[model samples]
Target chain A: MNVTEQRLPIIELGSLDELWFQVAGTRCNLTCSHCFISCSPHNDSFGFLSFAEVERRLLEAVEWGVKEFYFTGGEPFLNPELVAILERTLDFGPATVLTNGTVLKPEWLDRLRAAEQGSLYSLEFRVSIDGPTPELNDPIRGPRTFERALHGVELLVQFGFLPIITMARVWDESQDAEILGRFRAVLHLHGYDRPRLKVLPRLLLGAEAKRTCGYSASDRVTAEMLVGYDTTQLVCQHSRVITDRGIAVCPILIDSPDAILGHTLHDATRGFAVTHGACATCYQYGAICTNPSSRSPDAHVRTIDRT
Target chain B: MRLAFFGGIYNNHLALATAIADARSRGVDAMWCLGDLGAFGPHPDRTCELIRENNISVVQGNYDHSIGHGLNDCHCGYTDPRDNHFAQLSYDYTLAHTSDDHRAWMRSLPAQQRLEINGLRLLLCHGSPRRTNEFLWESTTNTQFLARLCDDFECDVILGTHTGLHWTRSSDTGSGVFFRPPSPIHQVKLNDGGLKKTPDPFAFINVGVLGRPENDGTTNVWYTLLRTGNDVRGGRSPLPWEVEFVPLAYDHEQLAREMQDERLPDEFIETILTGWWTTCLEVLPSKERTRGRW
Candidate 1:
């Protein structure tokens, strides 16, 4: 294997638990107000990872015992080689692609189904819908983005993909039950067999830094906290995510310079300080980086990394 | 009935003997066996064989059950698909690498053990009586706790050995729903002498598994010192027993490999490694049981 200079940043990365790829880098059709990376139609700070690059990492990860893969970006659906990447990753293990429901074409879904033909490990799609109603979602994700995303989700079901809808815990604790209830009911109308849901604690960074409040002085993860804490639950302990620029500590901190891991996974395996304000969230919530209940996944939707 | 209280005796026979000695020191009259008597270190068969030779009451847990049932899975209910893959592999490796006799012995054990202690009918289950495979930690629901208390075991007392928490709780108000001290869960009821005020309830105490890590991240195993303190109203408070874990070295890598092979879910493997998810599990202090604790 003739290797050249790597594209991944020198992350001093945490653990490389899974092999990851991004078809479309910082580019996204919808400019979600709360996007951690502030992805938008024009944001190209990161480029798409090539299929060849992803395949190379997949083979490399296998040697090191990495057995899972995830694909994400502004919207993974925006990538032209999205289906090809899924086709390749599933031969060895399961692959999950996170997407905003907008811009998903029915034909693309049919192609995805065709590629997933006899594979034992299924392809998972997670659709990010911020609110149960367009009123709640449109405010953050832009006008009518919620409806388009929901429409995209329906197409996925018609094509045999069970899309998991991810949400931020926007409603208060009192309205949580009702919020989730309305959310699930809407998903049911869309023909999803089991509507999976995820509620993320607000990461006051990136575009979200402006949506409400960014990290305050109190949000930082102090050194004293890690002394006796079981930091094992933090995703950075055992996993590093790969993006077009380089391997980063996790999908959440993709934009942070500190998260920019080395070009190669071998160089990425180093200690990281849970320094960022978001690290506090991970520390408080524990296991904030990995999926919540991806095992025995709901046959359609897959949710991970809930602290 | 002979219930042996064992704390951490992996492969080191010396530690095993020490646990036995500790149990005897407390004047305990029976033998008890917590699961994972094997896996994670060096010897799988020896650990199982030693427990068998001692004639300790063994209840096959998720690990023990997996190895015995020839399940290529650890079945710990882990959430990560990849980690689940790892656990399944560990399960397979344990099944293929371990001796056939060991596998059969692991399978032969039951979830619940029956015993008769001083005119008291008893049910001795490995983890919890309801699901032999479920790990009842501090985060375990009262419904789960109460259900395990009154479930199918028609015994007067329910003795479990999984979660290493050692507190004897009795239903003080309703039936028998006792809450112990600080499982890091808020709203825990005060552990006052409140059982006599209850309806009809027995006892649910984690005798503490004789093997594996304790709550403080230390390797010590835990057991209870039941003083049989007959309250003025007529009840017994299970006392805490101090017994050091005799660390045994078993094929942990092999067990991990087996879990990986069986593709047991990752959340469960992690739970087995680290006791229970403190976040998902809540502790709402002792409440009056809605049913009988028998």
Candidate 2:
């Protein structure tokens, strides 16, 4: 009962709605400056999850009535068994994977499309790009990373997959319309006539913390902030990430030691204390890592319509 | 016995009128509307009038609840800024035009309804039984989840229409257990000699909304007609109720003109005329979104 711990609000896992797997761990091809995990080929503090490991959790998730499964990391495809993992997941429920869109293979997409068609679920590919164009995106993700990612998008579209282009908001909020419009127009030029875009708020942590200003001391979710707040807005309320080491509270805070809740999914179901500055960002922007298909907290806003 | 289910009229009086006639022509014993009486289309009161005149049993949708209680937003639960802006515009138009009496009637409507037909228990709801505005997409929703909903609600069939798409999924895997007692625990005792392959008894149906055309490249809206049969399933032995998705073709030009006259966003008018969703596109799952013309 430290006073500091007493002040931090505890968020309970309402339900095991979304189960995440840090499949590739902190291993990525392009070390994006804004990457919260600072994932790079050289940085291997975290490791990839084996196909068997993911399968075990998929089976465990069924009993808990887990709604959906998500794969993320430095890059899930970096794991040799990523395709096999997704194919297995579709057997249980819908699966979504977060990748940099730079390293997708055609054979992988072909196999995934057949698997999705064969199963009663969907296999969603979420491709990440910082900005719409190379001039704007290269500065954050790396040189020529935009073209490579866009090429991946073209491949996905060729395989009849509607990839959701996930871009971290590195520019002003007002630039959203212009950026999205340009991205959509660009995608159309590359045969992705109908492009899906998700603009994510930048998280000031890990590599991003070094790239820009980290969260200030005042940027913490306090007990006072929980007053009449919809706790579901916080990912910890309905989700848990299964890292190579253990299950963490959320995908964003995997680097934090305190983020590790337990060794198993059941143990991870317990409440988590929102003490990190990243929690403040999660507080401001709900549904940070969830797929658009999954229900975001705001998806349930039922205020009567006086309009 | 046969019954017709209409989802989300969305103030499209033309579609509602045509769908009602179509349902009646099919000799449906009863017609039910799965709420969402207003928003999007023009003249909210006209759709309300059609509902009252047609004697369609209605359940409360998120839009109905919000409008009935005079809430600030339609509670459609859109996340994108562009989607919200268009949603707010539609809600404002619907609210300002709707009469207080209709709003009161909407407030009085039940959130969900249960009916028994030919020994089959059917639960009718706006979205899902768990929440009013939940989007239970076809590709994302699995058989296990639907079976769980059926078990929780204690119904053989659950019908909803919040996603504005028409699709049905039954536990047709032919291997998984279909019947489980309504309990929080997942552990359940299998019925009918335990290990015998039980027929897929539970069904989750999303009767496509009459509000607007589905994002499919067709200018026709859809509804659902469910018919009762012996064994809920007869010759098929496992297939319980027969579900039919009835597509209704309305005068798109007229609807578009009405929407335009109402000063609704041109985006909405574009949807009516083109059958492609131009706004509120963010809520659609990738599977549903990919099929659309954007």
Candidate 3:
């Protein structure tokens, strides 16, 4: 089919299973070279979401049957009310925070530990540490970031939390086993004996697009690609990100103009056209944004007759 | 009517036997096994045999689907490398040990079962009704989502067991109960006020598994005893269903010893003996994980 005849695949919101907040917006303490949104200390294109905004969204999320809540940003902890935001969120459902892991305070963690204990929901801390060693991660994330993030992981462990250490894949795929082995050993040495590690595929957007190569003109999800496919594997099928500007289709595409769906959660429920190269990446690696526990296990097992 | 729901036997035949006996003693009218008949335990055939001998209705779980079709992995939905390593170990062992006869039987099991008990519509599946390997953790699953599942499946209750943790969410309070009719004609009719009230209060129950300890630092596994009759709430409450999570204490030490003899991972044996999950920890939500001693 010609470009004019080719139709972009449209995926409807399956269920508002995950509602994420760009709490810190496009602002971070450290500007990693491969940062997707190019978040840095100076970047304030998107500002912090106040406690009231999160509370309003939390209440609105209940109406949508939102299963879980996620907090992300240039750095979620950069938001002054982040701890309180999370504390209030636990009242609604399980809460997961994606952080650079350098700005954590014992006082904040103490309050969070108490909040989690009091509530039925779980408070998950996904600490971003690009690699196991400073030599590998420091150049990408910034100087001393690796040590700072490791100390943050140590603090989380000390606070009785099994933080999921998230790392962006900077090396080749073949090095995964070796890298993970070394990562585990490093974590064990720091008293995190049973550390949880999550390796993320690099999203070629923002700073990463400049670091690597951007998506080519041919990179797009076509309607034909979705036949008999488990669309639920895609993040947009079950999640939406609430940003200061408005609601975005997914967390990874907040910078894109078309990514913003609407100002309200209800208005954002309209079907999304998978037309971006980033969307193709989401298709290639399904559920890249969601926690492992939330992903459907039989997603790839198409051989079974699920009658 | 009283029914017993067992989740994920996972080759723990000892727990299955004890739970069956205990459920039978409770005067359950029917017994059902939500699948995963093999994993993390010894002698997959024994669990399948017990389910067959007892004549319990089975729902196909991801593990059952994998083993039946000779798939590569258990599809237990663990994303961590360590978790997958242990899962593969368990899946390989179970696949090798399960008899072809039992594997065929597993292949024949339904993905989900719909039943009507005393005017209440019930759906039983290994996981959520839509997907067999879906994890419906109590803390993560909201009432509105459960209501939507009930509406889509046209059931008053959904009994599933994929997450291994036992918990229930009820949509009786009329929150998040939007009507998305199955057909466009029904949607028009509903909009025209043919059906006025919101969908009836429905529930999603994860009938705790017999696979292993609930990662709650206890050797005892659990099953669900669902009762529907005049005796429910002493006939005072409008809701007819009553859910009772029955904790079943079995010879877990024996199961662990058997696993050791079977050369299963020490992690599996440790969970059985200590009642704290060593493997498969990555698949647990934070609340569930925090509750455990791991």
Candidate 4:
């Protein structure tokens, strides 16, 4: 892995129609090989966002015509004020939170359930399970993470919610149906039938970069390649993630100081050229914002030349 | 023409039930909530069943959606250094205090709802209609508020719940208004004008929470009595029974404790809960119970 110091670009947070709240910001219990942020419990490069901070951004977004809110983290649960912060945020619009599912307890689901009960807003949860079962997933996520994550999934099903289980694509394209089928059966056994599963591509950065390999020169995204491409499909086009340091361009690139905008939302809402290598993947694949209310990933994306 | 909206009560059932009881006592024509019968509260399924039993209209709050989809985050915004809000002491205490089927039953909540009260079209949403976890408050701009209300949906009023504080506002279109009742922020205030750097002194409710002239600093569990007609004289007014108000108790200590545990700025928490805890969170635990733990 290349350890050379690179001046992170100060990417502007684009005409932000939305804001992503990094509740636990760059803090996670497990340091995955392919984690874009290389988040781990010990890595305090970014800390948890205070409940007040989140509320503040949410209020600001409300002015920008933001229609929704989303949360992500090393493990959002790592932040102590997560639920309270979410409750505070839900009033602005619908909210979706991403988590590893390993730490999710039944009671936590209930509190969320309760909060949704009394409001006029909505909430959704996306659980991260990189592989179908432990064998395929534990290798990437760490020891026993799959088991605990699956258990957490069971609680969600038992509670009657069919959570969207997100997994980074680890196998070849030919394995999609097989993996999904196997996952369906597994969820059925655990009591979920119409389960929503999301498969993501790996971004070569963070712990994953060091664990295996980083993106090669061939992997870089060039400006010419984006001509006529759907730029808004990328999270950077319309969304900015708020972390402890400040608002950044997207959830996938937190380490770059350039990703950090000043203290306020108004300052963050400037144009950001997708010059980073990751910009190539976004151009190739599509936006990964994953709002349940949004069109499916297949909706606006073009057929990728996986030749 | 007057309707009431609220957010998840969890095992804060006592607090919520009290709020509802107060609303009922005040003769509120209708009461609604976002959704989340249970995730952490002791009575998950029961809370779900209660709404079903009462037929309380609601949109699926994140907890309800997460539970329905088998995801996690409690889906509530509360953070648990140990596990998000659901697993925390104050939140868990409420969940542990509720029933099982109740929590389980909450999974069936709808993600969105549309209601029509009198001539008003309302979006009874748990989160923003566009997505969950999106919080819109009175603190938001009239433009943002109008956009969320008009462009997002066909509702004339987004009786938005959550945030727990009560608020109401007229849009730029003058076509409708969006309202948020008392939230965990404790107090309730409408769109009068939060323009000043600080919050407004007069709030949505006389009891649940008030910004400035608060008792100890916490939300005062005040309720609103929107009469069948336009009667602002609900108790605070000169009119007799024609005037009604939402009456709620204030538990200042509990408010103080919950705020402290949540690490709310000491100045704000101390003030709201010191005087209002007795009314709102009792929802806020007592200082003795939440000290050190916070």
Candidate 5:
């Protein structure tokens, strides 16, 4: 085959360790400028998954020995059936939900807290907030989202939930210490004294691509990159995303048409070619979507260069 | 066959001594130490001396690999800056104190061990079979993922320890609930090619470490004993086998004092004195973190 026909680096599914559900689909209450999928209140390209659909996938996941389950979308809370879905998922194993932390209700949190307490697994909430304050966060995430998300975080803490506050890196890398210090202080003031925080590398896709120049043509994972790399560091090696249409390779690639590999989890277990610009980001920051408990890929750790 | 497994000794020579004595007193047929022979404790040479003297079969942990090859860091893979700072302090201390001969021995250790005991293939690893430094916490790891490990590694039992917790999950395919949706939500049950029955059962055991207290507000650390063999009747035992987590108390005060004498971080001594982890808290899952005082 010629260079055009040659395959990109193909990463085989190490194991169906993480099973993700795009529960709310491509819709969000606050449309962040850096939204990888450009999810918004009106983006209906994809749709919410019903409780029955989620339940069915949960059953399928059990046989595959999936280690954990995750819920994502425009905002998982926007789906009316989300609370029920999470309640059901806790029964199977650990569950995690990625949200903008703007559309939560106390009653739902109460019921979910009870469900999590009753189960033998953990239910993790990852709330996305771009920056420490509105000044830095508002421009990326829409106006007024900072306070609303903070309120949502406060609600989570009230119900005995230690939600992990996730921030997309938007400023110079040198400013991380100051930004994180400010975030911790603010969170402490809001009653979250010991806040768990995660700073994620920005993915240059969707709205982000348009907002800040898209990826260069050379920003693609090449076959040579796999020579000594531990492929397991890449999410595509150990995770698959469930969408309304079908199962996709990973949460980061759902918007790519070729990402939908098959209708079932088993069929989707085939290798995925790292052919897109987002693949480079995934390579740079490994297993970016997995819960802290699941252990982030070692590729992200920057230590003294031993070799 | 009766066996004892130790996880992440972490240079706690005193604890390692006591646990070995206790296991030997209990009539264990064999003993194994699951790597991580150094770190977070004073006198790294002492633990190395004891393990070598006792003939403990070992697996190479991330720390062991790093120290053995003179790597810069312990490679515990902490993402938090504070956690990494403390980890580097411990790693540098350990590397500075460990003897060259011991590091060479660690370099010669295998990454994994496969043994057949009582007709069961038991695979011993410092972490998960696939990765040496992987953290397999009890609350976060599930049954199917373990079953897949068994299938891939082709073992009846896979034993690993790195998360500083001890737990066991039996993938006995015969257990009717092996692949069933958990009881609370079983409305949509489906048998998607459930586990097939085999002659023997499968299991995964995290033989808890002897390095430090499990952050359970107790000064006692744990080791695991696997009891497998025929019963008094000379036929196969009715329960097939048993997994027992043996917690042993040691003179942690002495260890803490020794650490202080060596000018080790107060944080390390605090964990010994209080039985609560002060450093390396970043890698802990929520369940484990919540259980700790710090």
Candidate 6:
């Protein structure tokens, strides 16, 4: 490690609270302009995780006391075993699947709905849509992709699944209220009245670096920046991503060579150096990758006088 | 030994009064409250008055901590904008209505309380034993994690109430299809609907809340009653402590009418009347949220 890298803050894995699987790997059907992984139809640098591989990780996660499981990919539905994978996951605990929402089918939804009902856990779907209108969303995502994703949302709602509509903030931060207002109105028009929305900060990596500007040298998370700060806000403190290559530090940094920590969950318990520019974004927006239900309460730690 | 545990009063004086009487009628030897005495209900002082008058032991909840120290938010751990908006309204109202003496008393309350009943060590807290505001939702929290909490805290039973839901997970019951053994190799045990035997069984119980309906479409609220028999064949009691979730019905309509009079948000009133949560929907895990009418 270099001098600056040596001085970076090392965050230990507090517990294996969340276990994520890169089910589809870096191969998405839609080439979104701001995809941090630069995933595309032809971008097959990584490979899909087979059903057996996912099951192995699930069993391993139980050993670690994993609280929840998440499935993501270029699109998780692109894999034929996606349905079975989620069906098996509910038997373990609550499962969430992150998808582009364009490739979902009725047959898959039917089985997932039944599985969720049978299990004691919940099955959540997070559908990615950039903005409220087609004009705003289509540019970042591909053309006509807005309407197709919206249909997917309607289908999920029809199957009694309330999908959390996740959006990457492409507009100015001040426009969040107005954009969310319009997004809620639009979702209400479609069947999702009580829409759950999550706004993600832009991760300046991969395709996003080429589309906009990459993080400058000053954007790194320094060791001084973490003093007295709740490091639990950082996803690396309590989570790990399982890819076909190995167990990565987190989902956002899977593309980085240094991100892959080990071949097994037990091997990946070592502390990680928060040196990447994306780590700065994660620091600013605490627990950005986790479901709202799973987010830690450490950010609100206030010193109260008991005397 | 018979003990009654109340969770999250939320300034609902009517429910608190009803619950206290119900427990008394059931011949409870001791009464304990899991804090959150103020929020989303009218007459914050009334709830405090009832607790003090009845001499109930209380552990500080996030809302109680915030109100005691005059913090900005309830620290309920809501991330959604809409949830925060409603939470702010409830906190402001509770802070303004709570008396200074009650706030001082709340400030003196402990974060967690430990006691031994019938040879069972019980740890009572507003949320998890580690954090005052941590949410231990049923669908998201796994058995091994619960076991770890019990082991770390050095308790056989961990009773918490923060997610406003009532549920229980026993170490021996095996929550998922797979049974987690001490060793990783023997993890996969297809749940045959029979409880697995464990040498040391721990239990984590979210003892429901008296603050509001559990988003289960019922106006009636819930509390927990833990009872242990006197028969002791071995070193421990012959039978384990039995947990019963007692649903108590109060005059919810009167509470709703009072809230409307105090100008509390209509959304808060809707939950009290309809028994379905109209706000704070974001913090719920999918399993809990799916069971509710938003």
lDDT accuracy of residue A222 in candidate 6: 71
In candidate 2, how many Å is residue A267 off?
Answer: 2.1
Reference-based lDDT, residue B210, model 6: 96
Between candidates 4 and 5, the one scoring higher on lDDT is 5
In candidate 2, chain A reaches a TM of: 0.95
| Model 2: how far residue A2 lies from native, Å | 9.4
lDDT of 3 at A185: 98
Deviation in angstroms for B162 in model 1? Answer: 14
Q: Which stretches of candidate 5 lie over 4 Å from their true place?
A: A1-3, A299-307, B172-177, B180-200, B231-238
lDDT of 1 by residue, B176-218 (tens): 2123221111112325423223324455556665444443333
Candidate 1 lDDT for residue A159:
79
- Candidate 3 regions off by >4 Å? A1-6, A296-307, B171-199, B233-238
Q: For candidate 3, lDDT tens digit of each residue in A237-273?
A: 9899999999999999999898899999878887888
lDDT for position B100 in model 6: 92
Against the true structure, candidate 3 has what lDDT? 0.84
Chain B TM-score of every predicted model: 0.62, 0.91, 0.92, 0.56, 0.90, 0.90
- Tens-digit per-residue lDDT, B1-294, candidate 6: 888999999989999999999999988899999989999999999999999999999999999999999998899989878888999999999999888999999999999999987788999998898778888888888777776576557788999998899988775565555453442212322333233355366789899999999887889999999876552223433337777899999999999999999999999999999899999899887778878878
Docking class of 5: acceptable
Tell me the TM-score of each prediction against the true structure.
0.52, 0.90, 0.91, 0.53, 0.93, 0.93
Q: Candidate 5, after superposition: displacement of residue A209 in Å?
A: 1.7
TM-score of chain A of 3: 0.95
Kindly indicate the candidate among 1 and 3 with the higher TM-score. 3
User: Which wins on DockQ, candidate 3 or candidate 5?
Assistant: 3
Give the best candidate by DockQ.
Answer: 6
Give TM-score values for chain A, per-prediction.
0.87, 0.95, 0.95, 0.90, 0.95, 0.95
DockQ ranking of the models: 6, 3, 2, 5, 4, 1
Candidate 2 per-residue C-alpha lDDT over A183-212 given as tens digits, one digit per residue, 9 for 90 to 100 = 889999999887888988899898999999
